[model samples]
Target chain A: MLQAQYVDGRSTRVRTVSLSVSGTDLVITADDLQRAEPLAGVVFDEQLGNAPRRVRLADGAFCEVRDLDGLRALMASARLRDGWVDRAQRHLPWVLMSVVGCVALVAAGYRWGLPWGARMLAQRLPPAISAMLSRQTLKALDGGMLLPSQLDGARQASLRSQFQALRLPDGEPIRWTLLFRRSPALGANAFTLPDGTIVLLDDLVAQLDNDQQVMAVLAHELGHAQGRHGMQLLLRSSAVGAFLAFYLGDFSQLLAAAPAALAQARYSQSLEWQADEYGSAVMRANGMSPALLADALRLLSKSHHDAAGVSYLTSHPPTAERMRRLEELAQLRPVQPSH
Target chain B: MDQTTANAPQPTAAPARQPQPILFTGRGSEYFGIWIVNLLLTIVTLGIYSSWAKVRRLQYFYRHTELAGSTFDFHGRPLRMFYGRLIALGMLLIYSYSVRLHSLVTLLVLALLALVMPWLLRNSLRFRLYNTSWRGTRFHFRGTVAGAYRVFLLNGFLTMITLYIMAPFMHQRLKSYQHDNSWFGRTRCSFHAGAGRFYLVYLLVLAAIIGFFVVLSMAGVFNAFASINAAQHGGGRVDPSAIFRTMLITYGVAILFGVSIGPAFHALINNLVWNNTRIGEHRLECRMSPVKLAWITLTNLLLLVPTIGLFTPWAAVRLAKYQLESVRLLPASDLQEFVDAEPESPGAVGEEAATAFDFDISL
Candidate 1:
């Protein structure tokens, strides 16, 4: 017999009862009152860990059985679902494996899984949606911080026409529009909107010494637009945010936001690198040294004291490292071996 | 009235003052294993199993919380939560993109959310209380959607329009709405407190924080003055090591007190709400010390930093044990005398789960 506290379903009143299995019937005895009900009619709560199991009687009453051994004796192991989870939880080796497995899986998800998913999603999205998004985003930015270009109109025209001549990898003319903008806040920066609109700030155009340097910057923006890096970044971070919300939502309200922010910085840095490589390819295709971008970056960095972000947490990786990489790529081709 | 008083004989027995302390019978090591395993499954399944994880986590906490020899239990199923979570993810996507589409769209989303949040919260509360049971009887929430709107929306608007001066009033109203209509079996729990009490707690915490910053700034200014003067005379070059040291000290001080503020606020409100609440005729007493709670919270923070989030379960259990064990129910009458209220109120488990579009957002 399993000793338990029985409560009639209609009330909170409790009574000490002895429950026993007789044939296919479960017999319940409370004081002098006795009853037998089919054992199949009883409703058992799902067993979790070592929690006291409660069985609701057929007549709306319920029994809480705290006697672990007795309850286990009556019920078959197959009926006790989720027992494996409970057992694995208690096992030290299993727990250690879980810890290692969790870390590795999370790291892998961040490294490959999420990025791959975001790429697929970004590629499938319609161009019209990105155009609308870009329009609204540009409008919002203009309302806040961005200003009309202060650079001379003639210079803007020359740069635009030169950029117009640049061909895509498939030998097609670049389909994106180039706009000139000035921003005191975003000095010496060029960015691509999701809809392939490249915004070249006056600070960057003015800072570059030659046309090659300026074309290199524009090529970098073109890379971002062609690869749909902006859209991919948006999709990726949203996914990461949703995942983080699920994983750490209830547990670490205090610690959750920090990791998500760090991940964003990390993602953007990698995208920046991809855009740079595309810029290097364009530079080599045009018979301009990949080292022109390195020079442009150096000149821009010297003129513009870049203090916008910390070393590791910036959207772009360290400028020196990027410059060194471009220099290395330039060395591979040596400007022109015939020259 | 005088005739009625004279007709009934007064009972000679005084109300018993026996304090039945709440107990938590959960061990950290056992829970750590559970937490790690749940985390692993959640990651592997792309968060599909997160609902199950939440159920397990809640079951552990609920099952261990014992009051007067009766432990609480959660019957919330994971499938319902999984569906709800999927819907919630859709809404999250809309919310995330709305800001980029236009500011007006963002405003529209916020207004729309405010309009329906009360309704959603109402169902969420019902879903929560309806699933929690003790002694074969489930807890019920009698809070109306209208009541939720009044407390959450109307009061929220008023607080905002008043530039948040009425924040204390809103807090008090939220607490009242949460506690007053909550029913355990047939017995209704109630909480009564003025906004002034809330204001007092807020003001005290604010004052302490302000005082801390003021003192720190004063010390910082005095210390920096020497370095600044030296730099001005010493080729306009400040010692890099000196600056680094000063920054380190400032950050250390900030982190030390910053972690305590959240815990302090929660501890104060918990005590305030629990102490004033009455479950049936029994008065609930919670004697939680902000200092002690803050101490545990700080250590938890310190431990989590070192363990890199592995110590989550142990920290949670430690905090739960302290908070739960500090509460006691002062019995006013025989425990069995409190009968279930409204016999017509039944079948919440089957009825609600069938229509379970709501998720326990708190978890």
Candidate 2:
């Protein structure tokens, strides 16, 4: 028999009692009260860790029992099986499997599933929505970071017309528009918005050699636009943010959000590589050599005094690697073949 | 002689009562195993099993918390919670999209949400409390819808209008409202803390944060940013990682301040709230130390990064153990005389919706 705290159904009164099993009947004995309950009619809470267990009597009364070993013995004798969840928890192997399984599952979801899902969703997003998002982003940037273009209006129009000549692989007209802005604080930068508007900063243009290099930079930005990389990156980071917050609900969301940002740096780096490849193809399709883009990158790299940071942390691929691939492409076609 | 050994016995029907300390029996390793299993199931089911997982998690914590020779229990049904989850998810998606779609849509959704927030929160409290039990009797919430609006919306506006100077007053009002309408079995809980005490706590916490900033500035950590800016102004390449590191340092400092301020606020407020709270004639007391709580929280965060969150279960258990064990009830009598309250069922929509929105009710 195990000592227990007994609470009758109708009242919150607790009575000291003793519990025992005899002939398929659960019996509760108190100083002045003796009660018998059928073993089948009783409800036993699953054993979780070593927490106190509650046995609910058929009449809604319950007994709190702390003697796990004795309770297990009674349950076994009465042919009452333990819950599968508790059974699995007790087995060391199942727990070990889950540890490895959970790690692998989460890693797989992070690496493969999240990116794929984001890419699919990004592509399916409406053009109008992307444009509106782009407008909002540009408006925000214009308010703080970006100033009006320092490049002359004539220069801007000439470059715009030059870039207008570039076409898709199918030779159709492109949808992207190249815009210029000056921001000394931002230093050298060129980026494509979600709506395919490419913003070229004056600092970056000042670092370049010729119109061809500028066109090459624009072509690279076009690649990002065509692939909807901005949208994909946004979706990816948001998805990672949402998932990590849920997965580590016990931990601070602030702590969890850090990893997602680091993960996003990796995602954006891959996107850079894809855009580089596309830029090479687009430049080669036009009369311009792929080396123009390579030259622009070299100049841009020279403009920045720090050529190196942790490559993993950087969103762009290494300049040397990108330039090497561009040089290889340039060598593959020494002269542009006439159609 | 059996029940007559009561010390400090008053000349009344009540027995000589002792302060019964609440106990926590859960260990980290056991909870870790359970958490892993639950996470696996949640992932396998694509988060559909989260409601069930939540139940198991809460049950483990509640059942392990013992007081007066009895442990608490949670009886939330997974199916009702799941239905609530669906509704919450739907509204969340609609609301988030509305923000991006148009300003008018955003305003409409916000208005709708504000109108229903009090009702939703009340239902959530009712559902959560009514499902929680000790000694086979349920706890309950009976705060009215109008009362919730008064405390939540009106007081919230007052706090905002006064530039948060009246925040402590609002907090006192909220705590009193919650406690006054709470019931455990047939015993009603009441609270009557002065807002001045809350204001004192908030003022002290703000001073503590400012003190930390002064000390940090004295330590010359602020000069690190100056050097970074000097390096950037030299027309040299800006190291992105350096900037990232600077941001990280700023975040670390902010978190350190939060660790100090947040725990102190909780400790002071919790102490004040529980000290003034009563269930029937019994009194509740909380003795949490802000320094101890802050140290534990800071260490937990530091350890979590290296372990990649494997330390989470232990950290959670550690905090729970400290916080729960610090609380005790000063019983007016033997503590077993109250009858069960009439059952009032509340839907899971409020609780699940709140979870979906990821806001804490601060219970």
Candidate 3:
């Protein structure tokens, strides 16, 4: 017999009782063994640490037994259903393995899986949807940050014609449009919308030495558009946000916003490299020197420092590293004669 | 209502006036093992096991906390909690997506949430208290939705309108409502502190913070003026070491202010809350030292940052142990007389919504 406390569940009164196994039936009796109840269809609370095990019966009465061994024997004999989670929790080796495995899985997802998923999703999205998103974004930007192009009409026309003449190596011609804007706050910057709309700021146009350099910068923005970098970035960040919310239970708005801000501010180094490579390829195919892009970047960095203000490089790839890679590409491939 | 009535129970139980300190037997090392396992399982199950993990964590703390000879227990169901979390996550998704798509819809949702927050807070408290028990007798919350709005919302509005000068009064009102409605079995808890006391504590802390900033700015101006004078007299060159010293002094003052003010508020508030709280015929005593609590908090933060939060379980356990040790209960009657009186269970939706929105209603 196992000594225990019994609660009838109808009152707050606590009663002492003795519990015993009788063949297939578990019997609960008062201290005098004069009164008893047959424990059938009772649920046993899973053992947690050294806490007393509670056997809850159908009639709402519960028996709390402190004898761990006696409770285990009775539970085994009755063949009571126990949660698998309870069993797994006790297995130390399995728990350790699960922890290690989970960390590895999250690391793998962060390094590769999420970016690949974003790429696939970005590619599959309908062009019309992308165009609509771009239109909305451009409208918002125009309302707040951007102004109409400040360059002369003739210069704008010439640049437009020059850009139109350049062709990508691909058989299917890329669908694109160029717009000029003057944004003092976003000085010397160029960005591509989800659709093929490219916006080049007046500061960036003025920084370049010639039309070829301007073409080189446009080619880079075109690379972003063709690869759907903007959309991929958006998808990747939202996915990461969801993952973070799952890992860390909802705590603060600041924590939720932090990751999104980080994802937006800095693009992955690999994505920058890919876009650079595409820009170089497009320049070479169009019979322009890839070195023009490198020269433009060098001038922008110098002028940017002279201005003593935050510049386009705030969100772009590290200038020194990107310049070195561009210089290497310029050296590796001889520039084709300009058409 | 009078001193005589309040002192009646005390004189009758004068022989049993010896306070029993609350004990925390949980060890950091033991809790760390459980925490790591909970984290692992939560990740393995893709967060579905988090409800179970939460139960286990709460149970560990509850079982380890002892007063007299008996320990507390948590009886919250994992499945119910899981369902609540799912509902909360769904709501969050809808709210966030709506904010991006439609500003007007988002505004409406925010307004709705604000209106219902008091109801949610009340139910959340009821659910939490109902699930917690000590010595086989459940705790209960008797706060109503109307009471919640009056205390949390109406007082909150007054505080905002007063530019937060009435914040301490609002805090007092909320605490009074919570404590007065809380029960351990058949015995109701009461809070007995004046708004003036709360105001004094808040004002002292606020004044110290403001004084520190004012002093810092004055020093900054003095240093600038001195440096300008020195530069003009010394051939347009100021000593670099002087500038470095000024920067060092500024940083040291800032760190010192932060370290002092944060712990001061926590210690004062905690001591005030527990010391003034009376449950049935019992009263609580809190003896938490501001400096000691501050040191523990500061060290815990320093350790946590360097270890990249791996020491979180240890930090939590350490803090809990210290706080629990600082409290003692003065019983006016037999503890066994406390009976289970609450019969109705609160709806889990409000509790779940509060959890989902990360509302610290316990505060």
Candidate 4:
């Protein structure tokens, strides 16, 4: 017999009752044994720590029991077994295996799966949608960060013609337009919009020693355009951001955005290497020295340190590594002098 | 069983007058196991199992918290919570994506969220309390949506207008609204804290922060600031160490202020709220020490940072143990006189919406 307190569903009155499990039924008796209720459809609450387990009866009355072992015996004899979740919670080895599996899966997803998915998705998206997105971004940039080209109109025309004349290694004719812009904030940089518009900053062109170096920089930007790196980066970061916020309780907005930005920077580093490889290939196919790309990178890295107090090392890592690879490529394939 | 002595246990005279302190019997090791399993399962299911995980976690905490030898229980269904989370995630996706489309759309979404926030908050409180029970009697929140809007939004706007001088008063009003409208087994809970007390706490925190910064500025720390100014005005010969020193001083001051003032205010407010609260004839007594709470918090953070948050379960258990141990209840009548009362259940939608928007108002 178990000591319990029973509450009737209609009234808020607590009555002292004696309970005993008889086969499949729970026999409840009054203090004096005058009244008794044998409950058939009895439901026991899930065991939570040392809390009193509630036994809900079919007739709407309920009993609270504190005897753990007795309740467990009753539940088992009644054929009411604990669920798989309860078993999982009690078993330590399974729990440890689950923890290891979860960690491995998350790490793998972060390292490769998300970026690969983003790349595939970006490639599948239509050019028209990417162009629209680029247009909106350029309009925003023009309104704040970018200024009209400070280079002379004749120089701009000559650079545009030279950029158009360069051919890619795939033998497919390049369809791209060159634009010149002056952005003091950006200092010396060249980037491509999704619509194949390569914007060469005035500082970058002025810093280069020869026209071949400028063309090499343009070739790298074209590589980004071909790969649609911008769209892929945007999609990948958003996916990672959503995943982080879901797993970890949504922290502050700035805290959530920081990790996504860092992940994107890491992705950008890999994209930069790919573009460097493409730039080297273009330089070699056109009978120009791949060393021109390396020379431009070295000059930019130097000027980057001199002009800005901010270190570009974190955002664009592997500059030194890519320069080394470019030098190796140049040595492997000697440049053919074409006047 | 103890029922053998039930016939002789008739206490017809006077009941015990001494107040009983609440007990937290949860062990860090046991809780750590549960937490790790919950985290693993939640991740394995791609966050779909988080609702179940949350329920299990809450149940653990609730069951381990004992008052008068009977522990509390949470009766929320995991499937209901899962549906709530799905709706919340959908709304969050829409809101986050809308910001990239246009500024006007973002503004519209913000305004819409603001309008519905009070309703969500009220419902969340109701849902949370309705699912919580002690001794088979469920806790209930009777706060209305209109009342929530008045206390949360209208007074919030006034506090902003007064440049946060009215913030303490607004906080008191909200607390009063929440406490006064809550019930346990047909007995209402009441709050009797004054805005003046809250104001004093806030003012002291503000003064301490200001005084720390003032003292730092008066010290030679401002010499770094002067050097940075000189560097800016002079040629590009900026001494990096001077800038670094300034940043170091700023960060140190900020951390010191947070460590000292944040815990002090938290302790004071918690003490005030719990001490002034009454459930029917029973009154709560809080004995939380600000210095002790601060020490525990700082040490927990210290341990947590070194472990990369692996000690979170232990830290949480420690904090809960301290808080629950400090609280006691003075019963004015026989504890057994209180009967079980169940209220209408509030569904999970409101709680999920509040969570989705991250509208976690610490009380």
Candidate 5:
């Protein structure tokens, strides 16, 4: 135990003082040591006031007074140590626990909830109805319709050739149908309907500068189909629909109002990013540069230059940012194109 | 203090060292154990008093920890488990009553209300759960139950129009909203990922799995037919059950396909989320490879089939560890702090002189 004594009123003005310490630094304020004793081995100077009122105790331990000088020295020492460990320590535990805990909760939910949900859903349906719906839906959407005879013929031929080129994992050839529609209002729109029916509007065809870009866009849309994005989304919607219908009897009005409802919904940025990555990968696998997709976006943004506020495309992100991201991903080449 | 003052003139003190590794690893297993214990307590208490347990766990992990020379503490008290259960019970009663009435109007009202309750509870609980901060600063979570209702309506709407071509985007946005609205004191959090890469992988994997089963079914058919043909030709007793046997074979093939691929898909989705994590100033870097994820998934899938899916509980524990182990904190280096005091000046002259008269070391 080492000790040093100082009075509170030795200043010419005569006032009180207080002292505090943080970490290894002792801090003394201008109010401190005003009345302190000037004992033997204790040296004092007016010039030394500019420096910290440092004192050496009996055990040879030293401390800076709590005043501004003391705070400065303490802060300086902190800078030298690079106090991230101390700072990060507060967040470390909560973050780690939260991550682990969240995963655990979701896992638990999945374990008990998934099978229960699955069985419950399965039990509600007659196998006959399920099978019929599946087959009928597939046939209805699978490449059966197109507008304009000449355009239809060319697209059919292109699709036939493309489908034949694709091989399933079990070495079977893929069978598909392409549907085309002429829509003046929907400029350059294309999508795969829920049943694997790839629909390309005449407007979409008109905007393609090259076969590769067209193929890339088509491939990206096809990737969504092949990935069962349509299926999951439909299944989820169906669930929501069924729940709504069961609860509220006759949700036709709600179904009709869905587009307006969706217009107000905001998705997490990550989900948007995920879809972008998926689309780009699909484009890459089909032997098309994602840059072309980027170029396609640039064209769309330019075409819709006059659209008020943020359009759906703009809401996704700026075209330049999307393109840059796609290009960065494209650098990791030789990845499987289809998967 | 003297040594610091002597060497302080050189702004490039000690060659300007980098930040040191904090805690090596923040092992959360202890808190996880605490969570489990509290969860069990909640269950045992019939969901009545678990609020205390939740607060206990939160305080132990969050409030007691040190950050930036300040002790972080939760200012808001957590809700009791009993209250949570009561809410659940209330919702259940309303749902059952609506179903029993079987009327269009009642059902609609119940359905709309049922959808809104979860959103409401989430906001209220979050409001209570997350309050104040690392230093003297306060934390504010700018979210409301209405936002949750809006999300529900919006998700419903977009899903209808795009016919779900935009679903992945919707799901992503919901996740981002949850993350962003969550606060650490007052700092807003954000996250991102490579665009749509996993969606492609999902399709490929699904195609492969489906294709595998189809081939297996075809093989079964061929084998069964060949057996029947041989038995008939030999004038031997052909099992009258051969037709049924072939059907069984197809069913078996389908189940086998599910058992093999289910876990892999699960692992893939889990790994994707884990690998793509972003929070505050830290990015979660993952070390788990695709192969590792696939293996974990396969194991879980196999276990899932044998235990009639009961093994899922234990499997979740394993999955969580794998995911957690893969995550590493990558701190952002953009933050810089500035000090305002003059280099040559003594910082403590005026205040020390005023306090010189009071000398109470014992007190």
Candidate 6:
């Protein structure tokens, strides 16, 4: 219950509005204001309904009450009368945004997502092919068994020692046979097969600066064996490139690259660099100068200049690049003392 | 004595109204159980379980949720939600046939439908969420998934033009929309308005790192070329050794391009998305310094490399909890008048009569 307040310098108190509730609606009537003013054209609700109800005072001012108790509460609490501002509703914009957010995720999943998934699937095919090629190549080399007893004593000992150190990712130490062939058809070259077989041509071994140079270069080949670079490349290429080959109407192009890819296995520039760095690290760890490997590259480049105009190093990139990388590693102070 | 007196309750003050406890009717265990069951079922059925499970999950959330002691009921039909998937699948089938037969028009039609199907489905879901009620109190969930789609499309368009430097700002604008649009009945949601600057910082730092790599590549190429030329023709006596040195330089270039640049970019993107976000009263806020965030993301990403993909779920859960716990709501109290009716006993002051005596003035 609210106490009525007296007006300043007036004999009468301020008028009170009475509320009547029915269901959800509240009806408000000011009896004193009606008696005093007798306003025209204002329809008075004889009964209150459940809907929101509004009442106009004698002064032509208006107020709305949703229910009986609401009307009473408003009169009691409204100490300082203030106007409220209602602009455009925010609900529509919010609804719009949540939809957009979900749509973006879905779109991203579709456009960029599915293609990557397909590529991942395609990437699984080449390792099988490379492993097959490596095993087949090794089997062929192993059949050409040249024993150390057939070799000259000094060269046989060095080859035997190097062969013992060569190992594959599967923990099988490589066996090498010396092929003393001087034919132009099978020129100076070295290659490894999948089943722990390393083949060194007589001419290629004879051309190296020293036994260590041959060892450093052989270690790089062994890196290819350890990393399974040939197999990985073969698998990746077959997976991605087979589709490309079919789309281009020529599978032979990929087939031609496959043999070369396996024989030399020119790694991605990163892998090649990693192998070089790894070779240098191993050389230094084994009580040899890392620069000795770079020196070996310099010697190989000289031999290429003398014979083929461009070195084997110059086939992919110039010799200077390989030398610079090896030199950089050599310059770094070894964290562990050289053995 | 003075300190104790100051701490005492003020005399003649009206008793403070006790705040209503926020009862989390949606239990974590219940939600987790539903998720686990759905996950198991999905795995068992080879993902076919998602269709029925999604409908059930939504129904469970709708049934258990309460506002003003009224549980909200979802009136939506279960089968209708698969409309999006159906439309997408249908369009894809048509498109595949068209492509196989070399029909350009059918392909275009398929593309257009693919763009529009999600939009239509979003509106349907929004309507369902909005029309639900808790007890007698209606749940007025704001924001349509469709509207969010449009904003994303527009933001994507803007970001592409700006070379993606505008992405963080665009993301923030999207958050604002999500915040402002959400409402409980007529009460509108609001957000902390000061987080845009932080989002911008994240964007700029990410942009700078990318720009650095692009510049670095160009510099590397030039350096490689210059070294080659210098070695080839530096003196009157043309040193053949210069060519061999050039071969060695390629190895170093490969390392920088392969390892350093790729990991750095991944780190930058991860940091911006992770560190910048904090759920405010209405919207999410990004407060982290982009550089610091990038560093942390990179470190974690590097560490996670050994775990394969197993660590991803753990990271996702942590991020979700962090984001959800940061969320705060504006203290907008619901105002409703409760009037107790009097019994119809004789000579009793009827509730209506007593209420009438008390002036229920309008304001």
Cα lDDT for residue B303, candidate 2: 90
Docking class of 4: acceptable
lDDT of 6: 0.44
Each prediction's DockQ?
0.51, 0.36, 0.31, 0.30, 0.01, 0.01
Of the candidates numbered 2 and 5, which has the greater DockQ value? 2
lDDT of 2 at B214: 84
**lDDT for each residue of candidate 6 in B1-363, tens digit (9 for 90 to 100):** 233224435533222111222222344433433444444444345444555555555545554443233233443333444444454456556665455443467668666765764455345434453545332222233555667666666676688899977777776666555555644333355444334654655755557657766876686678667766776676554355654554455555453344344434444443344333322222222233333433443443444345432233233333333333322221112112210111223222111111111211110
lDDT for position B95 in model 2: 76
lDDT of predicted model 1: 0.78
- Cα deviation of B181, candidate 4, in Å: 1.8
lDDT of 2 by residue, A154-246 (tens): 988888898898875556677888889987667678888987899988777777888899888888888899889999888888787777878
Pairs that collide, model 1:
B186-B341
**Per-residue C-alpha lDDT of model 3 across residues A255-293, encoded as one tens digit per residue:** 466766776666556677787888888888788777788
lDDT of 2 by residue, B12-82 (tens): 54532556789999998988878888888888898888887777888889999988767899877776677
Off by over 4 Å in 4: A1-20, A28-43, A50-52, A56-63, A120-149, A157-181, A191-199, A235-265, A281-289, A311-314, A330-339, B1-17, B219-253, B339-363
- Model 1 Cα lDDT, one tens digit per residue, A1-339: 789888766666677899887777778898866888787788776555566778877767788889977876766532533357766887899999999999999889889998898888888999988898889879988977689998788988898999998765556678999998888777677888988899988877777798889998888778899889888887877777767666554545557677777888788888888888888877776667778888888887776555452211134778899999999988876543221
Off by over 4 Å in 1: A33-43, A57-60, A77-83, A250-254, A301-339, B1-17, B225-240, B339-359
TM-score of predicted model 4? 0.81
Candidates 2 and 4: which is better by TM-score? 2
Native contacts kept, each candidate: 0.67, 0.46, 0.20, 0.26, 0.00, 0.00
- Regions more than 4 Å wrong, model 5: A1-339, B1-44, B47-81, B114-147, B160-165, B193-209, B229-277, B280-282, B287-316, B334-363
Pick by TM-score: which candidate is best? 1
**lDDT, candidate 4, B291-328, per-residue tens:** 88888877876786556455767888898899888898
List pairs with backbone clashes in candidate 4.
none
Q: Which docking class does model 6 fall in?
A: incorrect
lDDT of 6 by residue, A1-339 (tens): 222211111111123454443333333446443222222322232111122233444432333333544544643353312211000111334323433443454346434543454335434445554444655554454455322223376876777676566443244555434333332334345544432245565545666778777777666656545555445444444434433232122212433454335434343454467567666655655555567767777766667655643234643445688788777877884524343
Error of 6 at B194 (Å): 10
lDDT of 4 by residue, A102-200 (tens): 678778988888889888999998888677667778888888778998999999888988888787877666787787888887778788776667788
Lowest lDDT 10-residue stretch of candidate 2 chain A = A306-315
